[model samples]
Target: MSAILPPSQRLWWKEPVERIEIVWIAIAFVWCLILTFMMPYWHVFGKQNLSNEAYRTTPQAFAAKAQAVVDKWKVREVNGVPVVKPPAGADIYLVGRLWQWWPAYELKKGESYRLHLSSMDWQHGFSLQPVNINTQVLPGYEMVITVTPNKAGEYTIVCNEYCGIGHHSMLGKIYVVD
Candidate 1:
């Protein structure tokens, strides 16, 4: 019975790995270390720094804060939509709900603003057209999207995610002015 078993199987645990096996094992171990090192480096010096930072608040609380901003800086109305031009280098709030984005911003051509985005009722999408800035809008969580308007035009904000029957009507606007 002992002779019937192959030499490879008989002393499997005692057998030394081949040269190729050792090389492959070393490569895998090195690769794991590289990946482990990359994560922290990327987090510290990556464009995705905004993804890690978030503000937690209730929908009602965030809405009130957003409303205050709207009331404060609302300049005029363009076709029933209040055009809000936030001060350059200031924080702006945008509330998303079923079928609308509140207080469309009228930004300067070459100014940056930190946009605080949150959903009022359900999960929504924040898609800035033409410039093509897209982000996820979650309920009870405030996401800050830093944007610098390079062009002077009216950009449409469309909801890329399906929330409800009125999803198609979930249209918003951001007008970058000179």
Candidate 2:
């Protein structure tokens, strides 16, 4: 037989060290690209400068006291039917439950209302955000709250304070209309 040559041999330039170096260079390039899009490659944390005060009393008492200084609720007629209205300039309330809220869908599209809220069980949070207001709803007492729908849109009502096990999921929606 003549001299035989095996084709299984590799080129000398295809070295293991070169392959490892190439992989490391590629990983470094990808890390740099990712860091360019990140918020901070190097930075410092800052602290607040102002003082904040805490409120202890419920907003319902504040609202009632504040509104009482201005006006009071009275019995009136709507389309000849007797109704309870806000003191000339107040919001309305749709019934809310433990699981959800049932807004007053029986009224006209742009009607307003005032809520005299209370609970039968434990203390609950009555919060309407973007308005910077929250009230503590207590048992056996009607906590009146005021809201005005300046714009017709969908708003969220979040319970800022915890209730029980289902605390985080406690939420409601408000539908304002023209």
lDDT of each: 0.86, 0.49
Tell me each candidate's TM-score.
0.73, 0.41
Clashing pairs in 1: none
lDDT of 1 at 65: 82
lDDT of 1 at 135: 90
Please write out the lDDT profile of model 1 over residues 73-135, one tens digit for every residue: 999886687888789988888989997898788999888888899998889988889877889
> Can you give the lDDT of residue 111 in candidate 1?
84
* Residue 92 miss distance in model 2 (angstroms): 4.8
Score residue 142 of candidate 1 by CA lDDT: 93
* Candidate 1 stretches greater than 4 Å from native: 1-51
For candidate 2, write residues 1-178 as lDDT tens digits: 2235533345735535677888999999999899875534332232211112222334355445434522334344333322333433454433333533323222223444455555445566767656545676665455454344565655566766677887667665544555
TM-score of 2: 0.41
Clashes of each: 0, 4
